[model samples]
Target: MVVTRSETQTGAQTGAVQNSSEGWKQQPPYRTTEGDEGFEKKWTAHCHCGRVRYWLSRDGPLASKFCHCVDCQALHGAPFQWAAIFHKEDLRFESGAEGLAFYHAPDKSTTHRLPCKVSCAYCHAPIMDEGRNMVLMFPGIIKFSDAEHKKLFDPQCHIFYSQRVVDIHDGKPKWSKLDGKSELMKEVEREGSNTILGEPKNENMQD
Candidate 1:
């Protein structure tokens, strides 16, 4: 709802005016004047090229999940994509929305192994995806709160990395193995249980 300007234009992604003006515009009956409750305040984000954009509400703690399905690997061009989850109402858009694209891999049948993919309309940068329950937003797209938010709500778990190209053996972060070998596996594989660490672990968690 606020705008500022400097001197001359710079790069396509850097100098371009952010579409925040439109994305954060107040809804009617929801007065632009301060102190509107229905008007939810949200964090806005966009691709470097000013193509893909997103908005996130300031409600709820930041959370994450690592997806290792093969399609996820191809989509992110890595072992997995670490996504931060918030509610859908928490999201908003600004520009280049028409160019948003999607892809479904061969492993998909009833539904795509990878359900969704969002990219920059101009630069073609993959922005986010609908993995399980929460939309997997690329942390790099977020522009609000900067370092503080990054430190608090980054990726916490890695999912399906075994089928991914990059191996998760660094031990730099916590890791979990998949299940379904037997009934004992199911019993031992309860959520939040860990034998190696002598505690409960959430094995093969979704969302």
Candidate 2:
């Protein structure tokens, strides 16, 4: 998943919107979501400044997890990333359409990310991680008026927990890497924990 920046932006089911072209960017590196079955206005996520809005409609998410990858630590500038995966078709933009932005996600090992990150160009609030076949949205960004909606955003596990800078004693299962793709460890389990990278990591950081 990608972090965020301060540029700040939206779109429809697909195709086009207003006088804009195929992608938000006049050039490339910009692209744009579906569905009704088992779908309801499940959750709403907005940026830190509320310039960008994301409306998620789905019966449930594919997965919800806290990510402790180094990239997440640096990019999001958080102890870990709380991300919920959903079908692209199930996600849609609700505001800041004119100011959508993109940044290459940091993957030093490969340094390869095509449209790795998507956020509001205005407030730089990360909207989604448009990697793989689905989109990743911040569960924390979701606005829930009731306890039920809030519970839907709860994370099931922690990914890349080995790189965790802070300890989470919430009792969720932590994985050394991807679930099923790597070994599993409890939240209290770790060989040698690492302290937070540095202070003031969230300088100019978005929610």
Candidate 3:
């Protein structure tokens, strides 16, 4: 899915809102590298206060990207949001969901939805975004062993680049809106500097 603002604002009610992560017990436990023959690589992530923790089963994320949408900028209080995509089943909570809190966009009362922003209740640190079939995890919270392991979450492209507050010079593709659904914007060369294809070069100049 595209994981747009509208989708996060009003996701279909799947069932009763889960109050705890007790249901996560049904999932298999993470494997260790000690003597287990079937030891699978896993990545552990925690909130600011360490009250909320989770594990990713896969070695790497299914997809990773930098989102420049206004919604993300406002919610994160940053220029962009870097997110790693993973199947809903790939994530598992450590202890329970007691320390986790959810924020439903548009309407906070609607909690029985698929798309919602998960955060640490105490520290108020944004964790991951839960979607219907996938979850957008924040790479910052993950504990990577080294620089190489961290590269697994590197963004492949910039989405919603048209809404970006700052221009990026990276050679990675920049999409006007959605990744594959929108236009692949060309990098315009102005005064020996590259800028967005259709944007005015002058900062204070009106379009």
Q: Top model by TM-score, which number? A: 3
lDDT of 3 at 186: 62
The estimated TM-scores of all candidates read 0.55, 0.68, 0.75
Model 2: weakest 10-residue lDDT segment is 5-14
Clashing pairs in 3: none
- How much does candidate 1 score in TM-score? 0.55
1-207 in candidate 3: lDDT tens per residue? 233556633233444354355453243222223343353449988888988888777999999999887778878989889999887667767654556677776456534234678788899898887766677899999999999999989999988777776777777888777777667776544357654433422231122
Model 1 spans with C-alpha error above 4 angstroms: 1-37, 59-62, 106-114, 131-133, 167-207
Off by over 4 Å in 2: 1-40, 95-97, 106-115, 186-207
Per-residue lDDT of model 1, residues 40-69, tens digit only: 655666777876665555543356756555
lDDT of each: 0.46, 0.59, 0.70
Estimate the lDDT of model 3.
0.70
Off by over 4 Å in 3: 1-4, 8-41, 110-112, 188-207
Worst 10 residues of 3 by lDDT: 198-207
- Candidate 2 per-residue C-alpha lDDT over 133-160 given as tens digits, one digit per residue, 9 for 90 to 100: 5667787777878888678778898777
Candidate 3: residue 69 lDDT (0-100): 76
On a 0 to 100 scale, what is the lDDT of residue 43 in model 3?
90
